[model samples]
Target: MIAVLFRWDIKAGSEQLFKEGWSEIVHLNIEKHGALGSRLFKSKDGEWISYSKWISEDHFYNARKSLDNTEQARIKMAQAIIRAYDPIVMIPVIDHLMATETTHINQLS
Candidate 1:
């Protein structure tokens, strides 16, 4: 499985707007493209994080391409949040159980 972690440091006053925009617009665009599904999270410090899963890199790329030509989509996306970073991290899962085990051990430790 391919996973993407997008971290956003939203503009100071735009947190709620960002979430609402994402829920209303971005989520649909993602689903339309090829997203398996995704979860949105907020840190204690107020940063936004999105974890998106895809079947393959090609699907992810295609979806992104589709989004680019969408002007209204881009406008909504822009209104939702300001990007703090470019090219969010993509992690290819190789051994899920091993990673889970390591996480559990780290939490215990």
Candidate 2:
């Protein structure tokens, strides 16, 4: 699997708009592009971080290229409220989970 990390510095007063627009983009990537999943996080330093998983780098780029042309407009709208954008693609070397903890979590029903 491949993971992508994006760090965004949002402009003042555009937090809500950024959140809504980002959610929509993530939704489209999942539903239309076969992305595994994605998450958004905010740092104490005020940077918004996004983590997205895919089957492979090829899947990631393929999905991106297949997006509708309108996606550019949506991205531009979102970008208008950003101070900076940084992105990185990574290949995970290690991922660990404790089975007992996982079992405990699964038991929460």
Top-TM-score structure, candidate number: 2
If scored against the real structure, what TM-score would every candidate get? 0.65, 0.76
lDDT of 2 by residue, 1-109 (tens): 8999988888877776677777677777787777877777789898888888898899888876775544754675466455656569999998883333333542342
Candidate 2: residue 96 Cα off by (Å): 1.8
Model 2 local distance difference test score: 0.73
RMSD of 2: 5.7
Worst 10 residues of 2 by lDDT: 97-106
lDDT of 1 by residue, 45-105 (tens): 8778887777777877777777454656556557756675554547675645332233354
TM-score of 1: 0.65
